[model samples]
Target: MLNVNFYEHIDDTLLKFAVIVSKSNGKWVFCKHRERTTYECPGGHRELEEDIITTAKRELYEETGATTYTLEEVCVYSVSDGINESFGMLFYADITEFGQLPESEIERIELFDQLPDKLTYQDIHPILINKINSFLKVKGILNNIELKDNIIPDISDLIDLYNDVGWSNYTKNIDMLKLAYDNSLRIVSLWDVNKLIGIIRVVGDGYSIIYIQDLIILTEYQKQGLGSMLMNYVLNAYKDVYQKVLLTENQTSTVKFYESCGFVSNDKYNCVAFVQFKM
Candidate 1:
């Protein structure tokens, strides 16, 4: 039996290989070895004196001819076959450009909307792919959901979303909700064709700090990872800003969700938050 485990970090010396799960044009990238019909993610054993990141880059380029791409470390993973264990660093890559495939064991490259059934490391690869997807905070390809930036959604749609989520306070005064959205520094909305399903509102000067004023997903879409996708979009947009802030009710689930997105309580930084709501 094979067992797999994931970690946020591990000692560098224990990492013997680098495995990169990559995508090109939003499709999953996999390579077929010259000797094997099964497909695998582009990766290989770490070379002597080479850091794991360099191994990942070299393997990706050699296996897929991916010349231009962005790579991010996902986590450290270990696979054990009951008795022996091996460790590797997992990475996620977004490939934009490719060159001629280098002379290597990889026979060809393929792209698929989902993982292929025949995988080189059947037991190991699926676990690694699932880990990468979870690390990315994406449940799956969000079919038919279009993300619109800075578009103030129609008041009726907004009202429906708020009401569905039990935030009746916002729907009670439609005019004020519209006005608030209009004044937001940035607004990202998720539209299922004509229906508004989720939104994230930001308010800040765009330089020193940005506050997540509101982030909501329609009740039906709450657990599908649409909320995390919206939050990630805004986080990447303001990544250069010094501070990203938000306030929320101190509920267990809500706190865990935000913490998973890399937020910490003010007390952690020896600070406090103050808030005053209209009576």
Candidate 2:
């Protein structure tokens, strides 16, 4: 219910920028500058006549003293801190090439703050942000566009839809989607404004337990923390009605994802599933 575009409302033009995060021993390399006392990712404004990637690289070199490595845009954030009109894009860089820390204009450096910074997407929760996420195939949180609902642009045609395509093979194609879309089921789709980016299907009797099936989100959209958003919606919407929302995920990279979404694994034996396919 807060203003997300706090800067744009007054500035008329939103500011553009970039940031870089360098992971090191035990703590990440961060810098503090200007009036901001909190340590932030290393990067700054995009100079006129500049592109995004280049801005990220220049910022990286200036802050961390790491001149060589690969960088990727992890997430973009609105830099409307309080009344500030500046916007920033947070980049996650894998520093394959390591070097010494350079002397940056910013002096203070801190490591691992327990709480998310002022730069987080939810730092300034724009009213009805959920409506915006529900309508796009790919929506930028930084864009702040609102929407109602959009399953997919051409959902009927896409064959290997889920990032985990192998999972879909276990079930029929139409059945898979149908389960996700079943209004009778409390299944829901996650959209980035109007296009569907991922979906979560809830199955089970409403009383005893509800199983969370298939929280499939695209690889490109994974790190944005949409999974957590989906789970929050489910939990808050049905916390009183449902006693437990259980899910079974494979023991791979997915296990951690589930854990972060408020699932706890047990050391108790006899915890496994059997799917006897009728071959």
TM-score of each: 0.52, 0.44
Candidate 2: count of backbone clashes, pairs at least 3 residues apart or interchain: 9
Model 1, span 207-234: residue lDDT tens: 9999998999886555556777899999
Clashing pairs in 1: none
The regions of model 1 sitting more than 4 angstroms off are: 1-141
Write model 2 residue lDDT over 1-279, tens digit each, in one string: 233321101111333776665554434555666565555567778888777778889888776666667675544445434565455555666565546666657665555523235543344322212222332234445264222232333444233445344565534666656545554346556555555566666666766677775566655566455666677777766676644546565753456455555565644444654555554
* lDDT of candidate 2 at residue 118, scale 0 to 100: 50
Per-candidate Cα lDDT values, in order, are 0.87, 0.54
**Candidate 1 TM-score over all chains jointly:** 0.52
Highest TM-score against the true fold, candidate: 1
lDDT of 2 at 259: 56
